[model samples]
Target: MSSNVGTSDSASIYRRSRRQPLAITSAVIGTTLEWFDYSVYAAVAAWIATEFFPSENSHVSLLSALAVFGVGFFFRPLGALFFGHMGDRKGRKHALAATIILMGASSLLIAVAPNYTSVGLLAPVLLVVARCAQGFSAGGEFAGGAAFLIEGAPEKRRGTYGAIHYMAIIFGNLLGAAIVASLIAVLSGDQMKLWGWRIPFLIGACAALVGLFLRARSTDTPIMQQAIMAGEIPDSPISETFRDMWKLVLRGVGLVCGFTIVTYAYVNMQSYIPAVTGLSAGTAQWLYSLSLAVQIPLIGFFGFLSDKVGRKPLMLAGAVLLTVCPIPVFALVATGSTPLVLLALIIVSVSIAVYAGPFTAAITELMPRRTRYTALSVSYGLAAALFGGTAGYVVTWLRFYTASPNAPAIYAAIAAALTLITVISTPETVHRDISK
Candidate 1:
């Protein structure tokens, strides 16, 4: 069976499709809700620990709660497998719609879940179940959302459309931060521990609700729709993707690692810099926000540039910049001045923006449409499970074990070098015929 049926009419029509805007909106909203869910949970993890993971040692309880959250990582690949198959066999719309509702319901479940004081071990058990469901939903979200958005885009405009995926995530996280901060400001410490934390979950559920409504009204991408109408949807996309596209998966994993490490490491500066350096938490946060402010506006420009100059040059440059960043990093930290740190943070943000701007569009274009959803999801889910969540972790450990703040810089460099190697070997896919 041929993987894709090339069709200019479908692509052209879909570019002009009335549903294109709606499709993009649905995917973006869904993606935002997914990340918002993550940010909210992390923000309230301590309360969750106290409420559901009571322990003799407070540290142990917190670790246990975090461990339960980490369990979501294990479920992500499974969700990818399940949704990938559904997407290829049924349709992207089906899988996305299902995931959105399930994700929302999962958040609601957590919001209303009983605490350890009320339910013994069942409280933690319920929390685990809800979090696992959330993980499963998120597993499919990135790939599904990207494919959905990019496939609807005009061939030349896909890069900018893809950048919106990353933008939505940033907004979700910022929204979470704002929401949590407001909750903290309005509530007393006791009230926060007792109930305020659940408010974010409720808000996340509401975001999911809006996304679901949008998705319910949306159509599958033009490429996927063309495949379905032509009887081209894969009957067994799971095994087929693994058998035929494993090399692509390997390359995708490398890209995921590099992208996640560089981008997340910078994003998490506020999380760890205070512990490692004399930077105050408030100062770190403002510096982080300033960086985000700088990067957010430029992502679209870099993505648009990718459309003009192709993805390879921009990505390769960004990768190389990250690889040799240790000297600059050391120089900036040596001064320990707030102004210098802010300047350094903005530079890091631009590097990440240059690299990530075209990343999703490039990766989405690489996969064959017959099993695009499955292949993309499996590769991404696997890489993210392994290394995507490790950026901050690796930094923390490297600093601890080596007792040098500069030690953590190698983690990002190694990941970037791996990505650079992969990018060097891959052909420029900016002009690749994704319809095939």
Candidate 2:
């Protein structure tokens, strides 16, 4: 009887070990698909402008398209509120599954949306509605996914596991860039403007369907299960989080503001480079994609390093470098040399990875378990909406107003300085026990 019991216990343990990786894979797939959907709009914004926001002045059309893109971000905080409550009250698995479905549906809607030429004013109106839906789903997907991964991970490996959440983001961006580049390579510019833009959105919808299937098979994390069994789940997580954990939420905003600014600048640069430098659009896309690909392994390296040294030190180092490096890097990019531009992008990507890799784990540790999903979603969603969503539009307007090629670099530097202040004030959380 004792031998039989031991054998059964060993088999159960093995089964659990197998399940853990599947859980992580589900998180990765969901995050990747969400970001992929978001980025497709960005990747094809120029084409979207011509097809959906026609204007005599090309610049006016581009600005209008970007404005619509920014508008989507405004809905994120609302999504966070609704979905965060679901995750806290029901389960992370349930919230994530719902988010993936919403995102997939929105992307499909965008793919099939009629052009302005066909539907007139209603076309742009429909596009805005779909983008807002995507923004809402994304508001929950990231923070909810982060909380899921962090809770499921081994106590000591939280940083490394949380890093994967971000890695999926980078991978998703890379995928979008690659798809855009390939389309550009094969299609004439006129063809792209006519219909090529819709293809990426279609691809994004299909990818999201695959992600939803994977997520459906996964279970809630052990920490969430424990909370449910103990009846520790909050009745109103958003209200409870703000009422008691307001300070932590403020700190999260401060920490995220600079990261959002830097990241969006990097994302918009793919479009910026070709417009300003007269580089081949395909070449520019390839270079940006390559930089992101290289940064993935570097991100993992930094995440592992944080477990040994600490999250704060790596983050602080990154903040300082970002504050100081942008002016010089942008100068190199202005030279318009392919080699110089590639080098500058690579350096900036490395700095971004250093701080971003450990960010999710650190923040997860800071908030209490019961209200973590809601608090994190609210804080991150707000910062991303206010800073990240507006970055491309703001930078373009600054460049136009100042008539200076270096305006974006100055903006990044200021954002980085503000982040450095937050890093100094925030305590290290890598060693904290998150389950408490």
Candidate 3:
């Protein structure tokens, strides 16, 4: 968040803006770009080790790369504080624009970064700087983007709009997986090690430019506009977040923890742990993308359904499924039977859709509009930093010591079971008026 201390004119455009489609576009494109940054970076972690962290041996280099990757997660909470404050005080529009631009710039830097051989230690340093920027930008993107989209929606349609953000995440993941799979199929190992990895980052950079255009042209959400006119913006959102909204922040963190751990840790089964599925790499990636595609319409449908039935039931059902389903899903995946593996992925995606549909609206609605952006960002950032950031490492560490392939699934279940308790205690927010 900028401390330049200038008044923002972000609310000015909302009155003239009747085009909600543009607001939706701005949200989807910007979010897709932010998530695509993570997807591609995770896919290329090994190659990144060779390019920027040529230390000790291949194993050590890969670990170093992974460490750098995890380093980005630590910066997320910082970004949340910075951009959340910006969104609350400067207006959501300014925060949205700044985040997209920073993300785009970071992607561009990574795309053209020098290899260790060419620039010595400076190469890895540059990589870290870029990754940190990415993490910081992501920290605020989701909370701000969700608040922005939901604020612009019709009362009956907030869930549907919120679901678009989740759809964009899936789309971003699929896009990254597809592109990386395509390049790996076309390029030789040496080619991929040398220059092939840059292609995806370049494409991500280009996508961010599109996000900037959409956000720049769009207005702030109407709810945010009203908050501005009513003089409800906070002077110190961080203080308020810890003081008055502490309970809501805890609820927000619990709701987000299991959801992100599962989404980030396991939807990536084929990419990171392909042997678990016992399928050819290309075949697994394609089927994985296809199976997850099932979540798209289901998310939209469930979102609309939540608007009718209320958010708690759907979230409770999803949490129940997430707690119990991962073990069985991975059990099916381990069989090496292609059909069973595909079915398993679909089952999990549906569970995700069930949770994903209403979680954003339910969580955001927990806070008053004045502190919604900051509080949401802080809680979510903390969850990502704590659970999401450590998910892969914890799963891998457990699998190594326990000699059980079910480690990741078990980890997901335990975290989700925790979330189930939180959701059960939370009130239904569908009928609440958020503009206050």
Candidate 4:
């Protein structure tokens, strides 16, 4: 009897150890690929503007392209509704697998899309449709991926595990920036505008294939499995979430607001820097990529720290810094010096990383497992659609209207203030049992 018991225990331990790494990889790689696809669009936004929205007035063309970028975000909430329902009703693995395939197809579609010169209005329309598809896929990626990690993680280390999702996101952005920088370095201005922009989208499509394979092979989280066996999955997760968990949903929106604003502003600033400071696009992209690379380690460190020190303190501090530092950082970028611009980006990246590092765990812990995915997806999707998707457009429009380079910073500060309020009001969720 004792030998059989020991054998069973050993087998269970071995299986768990093996499964954990694969789950982590699936979560990270899948999210990374989706983010990479999305970031590619922003990284090459300048080239895309010229190619797809050719106009006598460059500003008008750029604004039109950005508006389309924002348009994609409007569809995210709908995606959340659909995918969130799937995740809650079917399983996390199923939802994640489906999202990856959808995102991959959309990215591939963008690679083959005709430019405005070739197809007239249909060109931008196709681009809009592709972006919306990507938005829909992304709507569920973060929440579902985070929920998967959180549910699988040991209670004490959920923060550390959850941080991997954000790390993947930064890595994805870094990869996108690197691709854009490489193209800019290798291609002439005309070459890049004509054909180079499509290369990143193609790369994104290929990477998505890899993510899809990994996610498809991965097993569902144990918590999700238990729910399935018990037949405890909610029939109407969206309605249930809104009915019982509205406060948690509101809190999620508030916490996500600053993150969306800061992240989008940081990304959009890469394009904005070259426009205002007269730096080469290659330099701006390289600096942006380097900044993101530096933040990856810092994000990991903070994620581990959140497990020890608590999520709220780090998040609150980050919110305070974001509220205070945007103006100074933008001033440094305006100097047009490579080193100063790099420094400015580093400062902003660090602040954002601090908050982002703990965000996934903190938000996921706020609700019960039954509606966790839906609640987080809906709130995050709404926040992103409202602020993140519109960030580049809003900043550009603000700068255009006010004729001030500081407009983006001012916008970030306002968003940060709202997040600060939310952080102050919400309790720390680091110790909560997600399985409840």
Best by TM-score: 4
Q: What are the lDDT figures for the candidates, one per model?
A: 0.79, 0.86, 0.82, 0.88
User: Residue 419 deviation, candidate 1, in Å?
Assistant: 1.6
Across 268-296, the per-residue lDDT of candidate 1 in tens digits comes to: 56545565578754466566666777777
Q: Kindly list the per-residue Cα lDDT of model 4 for residues 43-106, writing each as its tens digit.
A: 7888789878999988888888889889888888988989999999999999999888888889
Better of 2 and 4 by TM-score: 4
Candidate 4's error at 347, in angstroms?
0.3
lDDT string for model 3 (278-352, tens) is 576666767777876788789888888889999999999999988898899878887878788888888888999
RMSD of 2: 1.5
Candidate 4 displacement at residue 421 in angstroms: 0.6
Backbone collision tally, model 3: 1
Q: Which pairs of residues collide in candidate 1?
A: none
Top candidate, metric lDDT: 4
Which candidate order results from sorting by lDDT in descending order? 4, 2, 3, 1
Model 2 lDDT tens row, 40-86? 66778888888889999877787788888888888889998988899
